[model samples]
Target: MRSLTEEEIISHIPELSNVTLRKITKGYSFDLKYVTEWNGKNVLLRLYDLDLSERVQEKVEKMEAFKKLGVRCQDVYAFGEVPEENFCYTIFSFLEGEDGEAALANLTTEEQCAAGYEAGLDLNHMHELRIEASMKEHMAFIQEKFEKAVERYSRLDQQIPYGRKIIDYVRNNIRLIGESRLVFAHHDFHAGNLIISQKKYAGVIDFNRCGVNTAYSEFDKLELFSSRLSIAFSKGVIQGYFNNRVPELFWKIRSVHMAQLLIYHMNWVTDYFPKDLPQAKDAIQYVWEMYEGFHRTIPKWYEERQA
Candidate 1:
């Protein structure tokens, strides 16, 4: 909620002059400031949460590549940690327009579908990047992340009928999804992270969950969102992404995404779970239902995709 003072802005980026700084985001890990000048040029200053040095560097690189691929994203101007100041900071050109979440309320379902499609194409383009030798190395990190989630899930106190089913789906299908020879993925592709200007797609934000991985991972995330909204809408986004029928590996990818989400939500719901225990109980139940619901559909979904 605090805006950066003019003196603070001048001190942080000494070359930057006569620009006004406004606070934009106060999300979990980063504080975002949009620095604008009288001429309307602007840049974003991101002050990271305490102790996330590695992630900040990695995220910047991902955004850089995405920009080259014609994905609308901010270009990084600078990043570093000030030992004296005790904060790791990054600056990027402020992108135009509001976030997708802000714009979605005004868009028709059809417009949303088109935006989703554009995102899918961008996502697919990123996935098409060839990194043959490094595939295994990159997937190892993804596997490790998922493994930790699985381990965490195993430690949860809640007993849900769908947990074992979700586990089984993951164990059975990981190999198929892993066989992909694609490049990186934006593992957290969702509407909230996308930026829209006018009626067209502009760019995406938040590459924190990004890494070298399969294209299917991106599809999986989109499909899950679609399903949450509406199966028809999900299908529309899928068509935009693939431009054809869903791939054989899609179900496997879906299972993996599901498993990952289940574990993630469980960990999330636990760590910062609200004081309202019943709400937490309902959340747990909802995730369990998602696990059960998706598990039952895998067989038919895979069959349809195969056909």
Candidate 2:
């Protein structure tokens, strides 16, 4: 797709008539994103193909809902289709800060934990917007998803080591999915989507993957991303979300969630991002070691930190 010039953008969205566009090239999202200034403040403009109109609307609604609940996130300034360009767009108040994954290394362990705690608290707040699905319905959906993931993994030419063990673990603990509350989830919550300003979490970004699911399913990314960046921060997120009282059931559910990801996400990377397959494998290995091949529930990083 051709890039949209500033002139073309201003012609369609008159409110941004004087804004200069600078494309953001950091993430894996297929959306065309640009950073610009509007009304004397920095803003982000995300352009999605017209076919994804529904997703854009849903993203805007979710962002508005998160804002109303006091979650630190982008505020939608404007959103609509740019029909002439065959794409739709949303302009948001830009978050000013460094990426949390990159910034956490500069912070003290305590400081990292504090930022994670705040992020966890914000995530907990977002979950307040519960979806009306019953536990039975949620369980059925999870079981179907698990079965599909297992099928896909089975068909893959390249499979991770100990794939059978992971599948067995998920099957054994699948019942725990029924115990979870259905809530709005960020879906991709992790240090990579977080923003850090002056060693504190500024806000979260990239709500494109938001949806409804079992609440504890949200933490799978903590194993894949956050803990690799800062164990203290990952631990803090859990502490903040659960009010410093982590539950045994949480560990059980989290392990099951991680097991599913081992199959599902790896298949995803294989199909859509083959180059990332090695990194994905390493991440899977790390998870296996962290949980000791599902022999344990709580990861050693969280447990040793408490000790």
Return the top candidate by lDDT: 2
**Candidate 2 C-alpha lDDT tens digits along 59-138:** 79988988999999999999988777888889999999998878999999899999999999998999987467677877
Clashing pairs in 1: none
The models' CA-based lDDT, in order, is 0.62, 0.87
- Candidate 1: residue 127 Cα off by (Å): 2.3
Identify the runs in model 2 with alpha carbons over 4 angstroms from their true place.
1-6
Which segments of candidate 1 are over 4 A away from where they belong?
A: 1-10, 30-39, 49-51, 130-144, 157-161, 223-227, 230-234, 272-292, 295-307
Q: Give the per-residue Cα lDDT of candidate 1 at 2.
A: 35
Tens-place lDDT per residue, model 1, 39-129, is: 3557776665537778778878877877777766678878877555555667777768766666766767677667767766776666655
TM-score of each: 0.77, 0.95
lDDT of 1: 0.62
After the best TM-score superposition of candidate 1, give how far the Cα of residue 31 lies from its true spot, in angstroms.
5.0
Structure candidate 2, residue pairs in collision: none
